[model samples]
Target chain A: MSVDARIARGGVLVLWAIFFGVLWETGASARYLGSRTQWIVPFGTVVLALAALVYAYGYLRARRGGPALTLREASGLFALLVPLAAVLLVPHAALGSFAASRKGNGLHFLSAGQSAPSKPSDASFLDIRMAEGDTAFAAQAGIKPGLRVHLLGFVSGSSDVPRGTVEIARFYIACCVADAQPVGVPVDAGRTFAKDTWLDVTGSLERRGRRFVVKGERIVAAKEPSQPYLSFRT
Target chain B: MERAGVAAPTVPSFLRLRRAWETGVVSETVFGRLLGGFVLLVVVASALRLGHGPAAQTFLLVFTSIVIEALPFILVGALASAAIAVFLPERALDSLARLPLALQIPGAALSGVAFPVCECGSVPVARRLIARGVHPGAGIAFMLSSPVLNPIVLASTWVAYGGHARGAEMVAGRASLGLVAACAAGLAIGRRTRASDLLRARPGERAEAHDHEQGDRATAFSTHLVSDFLFMGKFIVLGAGLSALVQASVPESALSTLGGAPVMSSLALMLVAFVLSLCSEADAFIAASFTSFSSGAQLAFLVFGPIADLKLSVLYGATFRRWFLLRLLAVTVPLIVIGTLIFEAVT
Candidate 1:
């Protein structure tokens, strides 16, 4: 390729590096890769930037009167640039109830080694997946017939559970959205709420047969959290 | 040539190289056609108003996720490929190639442990090895095995399944199956194939084709790094798009019924591995979550995924001829199937 062409191509590469690096720095990468893999953005962006710089230097000495890249090669480079549009033009987003519904069977987000959330009253961290932490915290106060706790999650599930209940759900992810699975708890608040509505519910846990049902003392609307997926180490 | 900090392509030779490139290269309007198709797609999507919710949301989610996840690994691979071009001596590569095919293939496969890269990162390195006169089969072996045998991947596999009943056994199975399949494929290809038959001449490669043969390490390295990044990066975009489409549309749970039988579950998980295209480092966690599948089937997912995935197939297209990839799949798929079944019988 000509010097001008090479320089132009190198410039494009630098722009891509900047776009992704900015995405990572601004935390947009978390939407695509799980929060744990954010480290890749920083490390990867730097490598790309360095390669671009080297490419840019070559363009200076390259004479202006040179043959252009074959059409095939130019197109290949252009296709590489397509992701830039995907990043900048297409909207930035995080996976949510829409994704959950597509997953068929709801995801089980708990880590293989993670014990079911311990009781919150024990002053230990509860699993954030599926509102396990809140339920565990409430259970510690009592995993009895009438144990009350505060809970927050996006509403999920269908008619099977019971009336006056919502499935408080969250995706638990170890790596990326591709591996994300839905995990949720059955909450019986005695009032119906729209599906996928983010809610803060003050509820009590009751043990009925093998199921631990949360009956709500209060329920109100809430906003989706900044980071939607509850992350686990892969 | 007097080298000073790896000078860029000079004027006259660049022209000469461009002319050489035109000579057997088929001319076509591929990129322009692709652009037309894309514009048409946007128009159709807009007309249908399909950009509104879940379906569009899911498509973008999966598409961008694959792009984001795989891009960095490709960068790492390009850098390693550059290093090989700049620093790895041709003599060293030649000596390794001099060994018996059996020894060379397995040795290359075993050496993957120290490489620490996933499948995306390994492809360019393998291509570079082939360009440097290493046997095509050995290069292919390294490409296939490094992602599976790399220490981090192995550790992740162990950790993902460590809590299960046959955790250690699963890890061992993945490692052994990976090695056998890779080496076996390598030898099969090496026994009679020629470079012209296996490798394709990608556009923009001609510039480095000169510096590569000469010992002009600096320029050669930089040229290759740029060439590889651009070539591999485009295919990555294509592969990621294909993978995302599968992820957005397909409900994996639908296949849960296929989980009941031994060979069926193996084939089923193999299909999952192809589409999901999870990084080898993280696939184990997903495989482990398949509590319903037999341990052997889970092993099949872990073994087959790193070698052949929707993403890797696109990359193989970029780096090799079409038939080579088809042959590769033919050999690899059956080996994983039989290997996993044997583990099922024994364990």
Candidate 2:
């Protein structure tokens, strides 16, 4: 490849760093990195930008005359950019049923020091999904039994649909999309919604046997959130 | 070849302009046009196709995540490799290499504390270390241990598994197992191997070694860093794509029951490690999420991954003889299996 082409490749990498940095800065990176790891994208942007500058400078100043690029070399460079461009071009998306199912996403076990509750309180499906375990999920996370539950998620693949229940589920990530685990609220919507449709459900968390289920007041179609996964910490 | 005497068919004006731009002094002009057009086409096509299905969407999201996560670490690795190339004192390196293999192997593995480079970085440095006259054993051990034993990887493991009852145990298991495998592999594979036999110079490096020798230090460092980053980044992108494909297509149900079988579970996770090629710094989190698997299985994933994977195999192959991988794997896999079982029994 030409010296200019080599330098341009460096510039392209720098741009990618900037592209992902903007995503992280603007909250788009939450779809992939969890709360704890989101910092990497921005840092990568800075480091890569600097590296690109150094590279461009060094290559420009070097006095070596190299041979012309072979077809294989040019093609190899193009191949590296294919997936990168594909990822950045498409709008950001959340982990869906297919990804969730692939990771075997499910309710996580409780961490230490989070105790079981003897009584339910005011909470929503979001609270339960983020909670430590089934016990913590059942106890209203400050939510009373018949309050508005604002919930947003796509229908999960493993969610059992019946005459009146809607399982609005979202994946919870610990690091990145690969480890995203599905956490859903089984909502009694009193009607049926097709799977994989993003929805905004206004419901109330209610105790049912050993689980906390949502009894919906109203369910409306909603757009996919800019950041879809619930991070482990937040 | 076309008859030289035959006048080349009169090329179209536009085609001539394109060819001229491609070979012209300002070659970047053609590259910019082609890149911009390609990006536009891809953007439009991906946007149209992204929402087509959950599977496609899932694949994209996972693929992007893997790419974003691995790129930075690889860049860091490149930088570290550059430091070794540009800044490491030849005499110091020689002194270290002169130590007996018994001390050199473990010492190299332990030196990861001083340089926290990741696996991507480790391969290039290992190749350099061997090429620069370090004992092949020491270089191999350093390569094996640096990615796993480094504080970055260890800390990530602590964070990932910290909440579990066996978190500390798992971390310990991963470190000890990794160190053992690395040192053992170093001694086992590189003990008497010729340095020339242990490494193959990179095509660019072999060609440019004479030029770089005359080049200024700053230019050399920057050049090495950039070239190493670009070179390693190629395999990373491909590896990330392959890993995402595996994550999207593999059925989770298949491994659900295998977690109970310690032997099978360890092997299953080893396979996952080989395929995913997840960076060491981030892999602990993924391994931690495998809740059904025993600690032993998880430990195996952590231990085996940084040392060997599809990407590392390809990356290592570029710098070493073809036998390097088979040799590394032969000694490393059994140790991981046995280590996992021991860890299971102890924990």
Candidate 3:
């Protein structure tokens, strides 16, 4: 092969390895990779490797019987590959950062009037000391237990025992919508609404022995809030 | 002659010392392409990384789960295309071409149920089928339906919607409508054009010549695989980077602009689909994220994305021609719009 062709072929191989290697590494830490690191590391490595390989391959091939790749040709190939490779790598990097930032944060609170009820006030504060099984009310353990706090969520399901009582639910998303977990707050509204109906209620944090429950009055039906689901807030 | 201290040219030194640095090394094309890629990378990376609080994190996680897991699978698809070029029996494809369109359409749609693979995986398979002599229309139809109707996508959509009635309604509605649209487009284009017109394959004799020269099937397969990897490596990187940039640059609020108006929403969602080019397996979750939009609009997002999108456009451009892609986009966009409308009316 001509030096140019040989260099191009070698450049292609090195570029392939670098791109795949970065992809593999990014894939491995995709769930936890920081956004900056994800984009820069994977794509940067691929670009640098490609440049070096093309240059070296061209020179070596020219020295041997192989065809030489001109600087123009090498650079042209790099230009094409770099952006294309970047396109692929960027998402992984962006997602990695997104995942990290979203780790424990609940879903975007879509309530018009009330902020998502959090113990620490700021949604960014993740309660690491809190036990996994603990409910939101459980976080209020030592505080005056019966303090009335406004709560809002969607009705997940209803209970038949208390005439027309229902359980209102919301999901907290830690990252994407998939990892959302439905969290319920029991409501004793006199009438029943359909499942998945959005509602707002004035409720007091109640402890039925060790169990935490929301005992509320006047559950009112409302329009579906944007992002009605609850996501995890880390 | 025997001069004292005369040194011979050593092969290793000669190899090492060869002046490789030529002037005018970087051309405008190379510089431009690399710079464009770098800019895109930086923009996307910053968008993903610099955001504060929960929203940023949610975006990141969603991006990762949906986009990252999809890369290897796509690479496999590209690699598979290369492999088919290397080793698969070309004659077997003739049987597929001879099958009636009636059998072919449904058969292609149902084929998705057999595999959990996503749209990216389908690309290579479709290409291989085309190379093997399947009608371009049939192969295209299979590509469209395979991702949406696949078992994994169905199951995921079902899980997201929370049961049989809703899930069935969503899947059946989207699947049937998408199938009709894709098949219609394929048939329309297929009638006027020959399969050879779509993608110019190497002459059969040349392929056969390469096949004979190789010592054995294994060696040929390996060679083809390596070349295939090299051929597709750049595109994979490009596709991934473009997806990231779209994810980062476009805000979720941008979706809200199209809310309530089904037509506008459909168009906007289609644009998003084009830009995001998300893997079909996980597009459901992203679609669900567009909670503000109606089911019809969400359905359009899912249907349009798998069939035609930026990444797919690039891939198609790489394989086919600009004229073909432009024609494809013209057909596919209207079909998706009509499908979305039908879904809205029925559901």
Query: Candidate 2's residue-wise lDDT over B1-347, tens digit each?
Result: 86668676988999877665444443445556667888788867765775457777777777778767767777887787787777888897889877888999999889876667678777777777777778999899999998988887887787776545566776778889999998999999999998998786554575345546885776787777876777777777676677777777876556545555788898888887787777787787777667778878889999999999877887787678999999998999988999899988887
lDDT of 3 by residue, B1-347 (tens): 97789687666754444433332344446645655776677678667655333344444444343334444455456556655665666666667668987777667666766656677667766766776677777777787778878777776665545445766777776677767766776676654566668764421224333643654454344334433434444454556556545555555456446555778888887887777666665565556556567778878887888887766776676555457677777887887777788878877
lDDT of 2 by residue, A162-210 (tens): 4356678877666677666677778887777777889987766666654
For candidate 2, the per-residue lDDT at A223 reads: 89
The numbered model that scores best in DockQ is: 2
* lDDT (10s digit) by residue, model 3, range A102-167: 221221121101123355322211121122234542354322346565666666553422334566
Whole-model Cα lDDT of every candidate shown, in order: 0.73, 0.72, 0.54
User: Candidate 1 chain A — worst ten consecutive residues by lDDT sum?
Assistant: A121-130
Per-candidate TM vs. native?
Answer: 0.85, 0.85, 0.58
Error of 1 at B9 (Å): 37
TM-score of chain A of 3: 0.39
Most accurate candidate by lDDT: 1
**Model 3 / residue A92 / CA error / Å:** 12
TM-score of chain A of each: 0.75, 0.78, 0.39
